[model samples]
Target: MQEGCIEWKLDEKENINSLEELARHGARVMLRIALNDEIKEFMEKGETLRDEEGRRLVYRNGYHREREIQTGIGPIKVKQPRVDSRKAEVKFNSKILPKYMRRTESIDAFIPILYLNGVSTGDFSEVMEGLLGKGKGVSANTVVRLKAEWEKEYAEWRKRDLSAKRYCYIWADGIYLKHRDEEDEKSCILVVIGVNENGDKEFLAIDSGIRESALSWKEVLLGLRERGMEEPKLAIGDGGMGFWSALREVYPQTREQRCWVHKTANVLNQLPKKLHPMAKKMLQEIYLSPDKAQAERGIGRFVNVFEDKYPKAVKSLTKDAEELLTFYDFPAAHFQHIRTTNPIESSFSTIRLRTKKMRNCGNRKTTLAMLYKLSQQVEKGWRKLRGFKEIPYVLEGMPYLDGSRMENAVV
Candidate 1:
């Protein structure tokens, strides 16, 4: 406790001020050792302090380049040792290395792993092993453990405070995750995303199976309701069987917008490969028309023009015509944002690629964990995407939505 004197003790001791003193207090008797470089340097410069024995001594300063070579013991201050004039030797000893140094073989040794966009643990390991030196830091276990934490963090993130109604629009779309079932086969996992009132996004739900059944979608919607999302003013998604049914059951008043992009893809799929160019042009004319009426007119003309050669394409188009054009009645300015589920698709594309590497998810928990982590990671860096700002004016054009309230309901 004296000034300039080293005080040492174990971390539990809570009183030690120096490593040397701590070692001294331990069960094993050990001398506190230190090289006072400055004192040694002064001594090398012909400096001497009289000792009890009164012997002339020289202490040479040692350093690893610019770094000071430091070692010490509790302030008992033993006489400095003399070095052999013929042979000079210096040994380096580290008091303590980072804890990560101990578990070098385990993947978890890599702490505070930099989670990057479009980067995977496998890819990161490859970069460390192939590009950088492999044995320098953590082992395989460290990497797996870090990934497991990410997955766990993601699960916790999904359950975070969603009780408040800040989201103006809740767009729900299912991305099909490639998975395998009981027989060790391939299957699909449906992952849902929600755009909050502030235009921020989050994972709404996740489920697995080949079919996105009504029951499955219903459960997802109900879960959202239970999680504090009472109802959204608008629920936009690609029209799937149980998807709409779930919406109706959960929020009958929610406005629906069918993804125009999916409809276009389906329509294009129905056309022959050679006619894709022509079909694309026709589809564009309908989608990009000046206004809702004009777009509708364009579709009518498209069907008439292609009826003979591509009857099936036109039929397919007709089936999804209303849903595809759902955004039309909303507001012309909002068309860009509501036209398609492309925003959700962008997320799906990344999810598909990440999960695609795995042959099959080990279990439902594992699958959900990965999706939750991946989605949360992506959302963290997401910016508020610009949508149709002019749509408010268009909404004013529709007298019904523009009205003070729809109070005619008997219920």
Candidate 2:
């Protein structure tokens, strides 16, 4: 073995304690080598970069005095590499490990998520201390400060310009979150999500609204317009009267498509509890039909069976008949995507639980800000729309008939 080097065999067996020891040993070894590499690249300027003495300007001096730094796995002792520069104005600093950083950034990041996920503030100190070491836990006051920053971030995001924004399609919905008190339950958050020409989906708005009313929805739509959001090619949402009314006023050119999932749920609500299983199947057949004509026929079958005894259900199903089948006029690859507002619904399924946990935690503005921050986190995981290649065709006003692109046909 080399006098100043270490090696290991992967086939060696070890216990948990030994494994942790091995991890600590590995951290020290890697840090030493990485620091040395940083110095090697700093010595040159140009082809004739060296001094007349033909010597490189920046050279390694030695390791800084060792210090124990805190990490997720536990504290590890490290010695940063030192650089002696002939150029007095230039000095090297380790971005990987700053001079005063006693703890890893991961520890700081983990604390807030822990607190927000139902860990009470009082218990935060003990929980973090156990993981990062004694005296390292952040105070509850610190958490409060972090939360204030959260509010400011969400406020700034609300006013961002959208002058260059355009979406092929959008999904709008009003989500009612339950609170500890009944009065708080009356208010709902209105969400608008749009997919740009690149097919990347993004949140356009998340504002507290008065139960999806026309006036409330008008503000969101107007805000999007004020920020220069262009009219989407189509908008998919439930049979919300307020949203449709607002859409007409702001972007009448954008066609409407009713969410089949919500419409089916509404139709079943009007039927007998005993008939739900049967009626639901009938409703599915309508939207799941292979083509617009077949889907309309399926709707006919449903109305014929229920109209005599269930006039209300029949009306509910037939009222939005045209909008419900609008997906057929777009790319068949997007039929499942456009037939419903599942993009918004699926993205928010997790937020509903967080909202429930946060019941009575704060007032309307604060609550919304927290939701905005959390949603921004959730937004990171959203995937692009399926069949994104067809987005250009959608934006160009290419005609579609029963999910087939009719390129040569007239509008």
Candidate 3:
């Protein structure tokens, strides 16, 4: 029985080894074929030989050197075709394998995504060594270089023009990251996302702040204004955050909506554990109602049911009552987006997952840069909000009556 088990283990090891070898061999063949095809196309197009004045310059020079490129499958050897052109200096550069490129750009881009997916910098070498072979591991230096590049990218993204664009709605939130140096220290990252006139969501600002304080939020909002970001029609955020206070001071014209998710959680926290499920259902009724009138009825029922026993919970619900139902005034199609700050939540889910595992994310600059890069990656998959076509009407100040355009509304 022991002999059979040993044989099974050996067979499994052999199979895994063979699969990796096969992948490397296949990649080599594909790369060689592609390079050969590029040469053939170049020669056929008369690109190898150019006529300068009356002198003909020939660029067809034999293969200069053989190089090995590290790929996910392992290192694949490639022969670089060189050109010795007289009169006109021309070089044969393969689009498949660029000059001095040891690794593919796709591999470079994937490294950061992997880092943001909860793979720590120290674990990168081990993780990559498993996927790629022994010496092909991603070094710490490479990660540092990538972080530097990402910092430059973040800087450029922050300075982009917002004067030409207008947002219909914005979601604001502050996320805290624990510092490694100090156990008691936590840094707050204030983030804002805007839905444009086209109903497309965009990441607007990500700045380091002081625990979502009114001053911190005001600095962020003022920065947006300085960058030429027009005042959005509505802003959604947690009821307890200082964002509302800052918004009132910066752009009072922008209406406010308290996130139903945050409000529900706050109310539930104040109530008894057993009352949570029923209390949550009652709160949902208020947000999910067809119109403001029905929503108000739902709110009244909740207040009446909890006021006597859970007066504090009832107070939590009624304190932001007007803000909670502000979405009803907007087009019905947009209510789902306006009712909550899910857009910000969804984008930061990756950052939260990664940072929680990290516990202490270096310094404030590094933390903000990491969060910005992670958010940028997440923004790629974000879908346009539903009922996007109505954005123009919203921007035009047309009144929406119970989620529909008001009758005989003037342009």
Candidate 4:
């Protein structure tokens, strides 16, 4: 060691601490110092401390409260200082640890993600315990309480007023979940998503149904009507869904578009495996065409190529020919969104993966609440559709010819 330089040595018995632990300890010390400084400033300004003529300002009462604040490292217990006011009304509130805040917002948000990923409510404590040390994690009772709050939120959301709401487009589908018990059949949950005039996607409805039957769908549509949801300009869905018949009965004027993705899969299912490659390409031509005439020509070529050898496949493709081609009449920029119910499909894909892992969700109410919570989480990532600005024209019943603006068309 040099004369001016200091020497370093390792302590034999001192506990080695990780960087995260040091950072957390530093934050705790700073927080306490900050709160004490706030109290000091109040005390200095107080009339009692200054011996002024006016009534006493805020003064130190005592440290009467203790709270555990959740941080990245773990939950930290802190003593909250109290204050007494004489003339000026004042309250001691630490910006670092807000009143009644058990966990940070980021930590609170993580709970639903864990729940949606198949972590049961009762097991949250175990999961958190692994992340945080023992005794410093969210309790199962807390998770159950949060779930009850979500149930109330979902109930309130379902009954909200939609009288002034109008959607430019709608997508309908029925999601089937595994049977609860061996004796019971699987259940269907009908879902509807809508695109408002601003082209924002919204989860409109999620209801229990019986295998997408006409009556089941009718009840859902009737509910929407009773809730004051105006008939959307166009509805997109799989042709096989019972939604079509019910939609026609409820909102007869609304145009329909069969989802090309569903149509492609249905057509491919009927064809031989060897023909799938060629058949899929042929189906793509019909949907990806530039205009209705081009699409029709593509369909004609498909029919000519497979009508004899694979009548079932060709029939499946041609059955919803008009509905499949409905996208060509809409704005070219919005054709991608209008051609399929992919938005709804993508969102439900998360639910499908979650439910598959869980095998069977609890009861109908519990299942709906979980689904609603999952949708709320998924909706955060949903981007606005392309050509969103053109939605207002669609809502005004503006017609388009070959994906071009048709001037002065009658509404």
lDDT of 2 by residue, 1-411 (tens): 988886754324433357666786677667766766666565443224457799866777887888888788777888777777777776777777888787676665565445434466677778878875688666788667767887798888889998786689999999776533355654888999898998888888989899899999999999999988999999999998999999999999999999999998999899999999999998888888888889899989988899999999999999999999898999998888898998888866765667466634345665666667666766778888889999999999999998889978886
Candidate No. with top lDDT: 2
Candidate 1 vs candidate 4: the lDDT winner is 4
Q: Per-residue alpha-carbon lDDT of model 3 for 101-124, expressed as tens digits?
A: 987655665675566455778878
What are the lDDT scores of the predictions, listed in order? 0.56, 0.80, 0.80, 0.80
RMSD to native for every prediction? 17.1, 5.4, 7.3, 7.0
Lowest summed lDDT window (length 10), candidate 2: 8-17
lDDT of 4 by residue, 271-308 (tens): 88998999899888788888899999999999999898
**Number of colliding residue pairs in each model:** 23, 0, 1, 0
Cα lDDT, model 3, residue 352: 71
TM-score of 3: 0.78
Candidate 2 at 371: error in angstroms?
1.8
What is the Å distance of residue 256 in model 3 from its true position? Answer: 0.6
Q: Tell me how far the alpha carbon of residue 231 in candidate 4 is from the true structure, in angstroms, after superposition.
A: 0.8
> RMSD in Å for candidate 1, one decimal?
17.1
| Candidate 3 colliding pairs | 332-403
Candidate 4 clashing pairs, residues 3+ apart or interchain: none
